[model samples]
Target: MLTPSKVLDLYFLEARCMLIEVAATLDRFDRAVDSDTNGDGGDDRIEKLYESLQVLSSKSETPDRSEQLLKLFSGPA
Candidate 1:
C-alpha cells in the first residue's frame, strides 16, 4: 500500500531523475562543444549549457531530493 508520503516521495524522485538526465545531456553537449572553432561564438552555447546545469544542481538540493538523481540511484545525498 502506498501512503501519501510515499506517493509524494515517488513523484519527487521521478522529477529529480528527469532533471538529472537533462543535466547530464546538457553537460555532455557542452563538453562536446569544446572542440568547436568559431571565434568564441561556439563558446556561447557551452556557457548556456553550463548555466542550465548549475540551476539543475541547485534544484536537486532538498531533503529527500538532495541527490544527483531524484532517488533513482543509490548515490550520495
Candidate 2:
C-alpha cells in the first residue's frame, strides 16, 4: 500500500516528465516553423499554449477560508 506522500511524489514525477516532453515538442515545432517561409497562425497558438502551461505549472498563493468561501458563493469573477 502506497502512503499519501508516496502517491503524491509519483504523480509529481509523472507530471514533470510529461511537461518536459511537451516543452521539447514545442521547441521542435518552433524550430520547424523557423525553417519554413510560410507564415501560419501556429506560432501564436503555440505561444498561447506555452503561456497557459506556465500558468498551470505555477504555484498560486492560497486565499484564507473567508475569501475562499466568498468566492465559492460569488462564483468566478
Candidate 3:
C-alpha cells in the first residue's frame, strides 16, 4: 500500500483538477439562460449531484466516499 504522503503526491493534482472541472461544469449549468429557476426546474439527477457533493465532503463511518455516493445515486431509483 502507498504511504499517505505517496498517495497524496500521486493523486492530489489529478484530484484537484477533477474538482475544478466539476465546479466549472456546475457553474456553466448555472450560467445557462435556459436554467431559470421559475418553477420545478430541477430533477433527481441534479439533486443527487448536490447530495453526492455533500457526501464527498462529509466525514462518515464509510471510508469510501465513492461508494457512499454510488449508494446515494443508486438507491430507490
Among these predictions, the greatest lDDT belongs to 3
lDDT of the candidates, in the order given: 0.61, 0.67, 0.82
Residues 9-57, candidate 2: write the lDDT tens digits.
8798897898799889888887987887877537455755656565565
From the highest lDDT down, the ranking of the candidates is: 3, 2, 1
Q: Least accurate stretch of 10 residues (summed lDDT) in model 3?
A: 33-42
Single out the weakest 10-residue window by summed lDDT for candidate 2: 63-72
Top TM-score: which candidate number? 3
Across residues 1-77, which tens digit of lDDT does each residue of candidate 1 receive?
88989988879889789878877877766676675676343545455555545555574445443343334333455
Model 3, TM vs. native: 0.79
Q: Model 1 lDDT vs. the true structure?
A: 0.61
Candidate 3, residues 1-77, lDDT tens digits: the string is 99999999999999999999999977876676376767555567777888889988888885899877778868586
Colliding pairs, model 2: none
Q: List TM-score per model, in order.
A: 0.38, 0.55, 0.79
Q: After superposing candidate 1, which stretches have Cα over 4 Å from the reference?
A: 1-7, 37-77
- Residue 66, model 1: Cα distance from true site in angstroms: 23
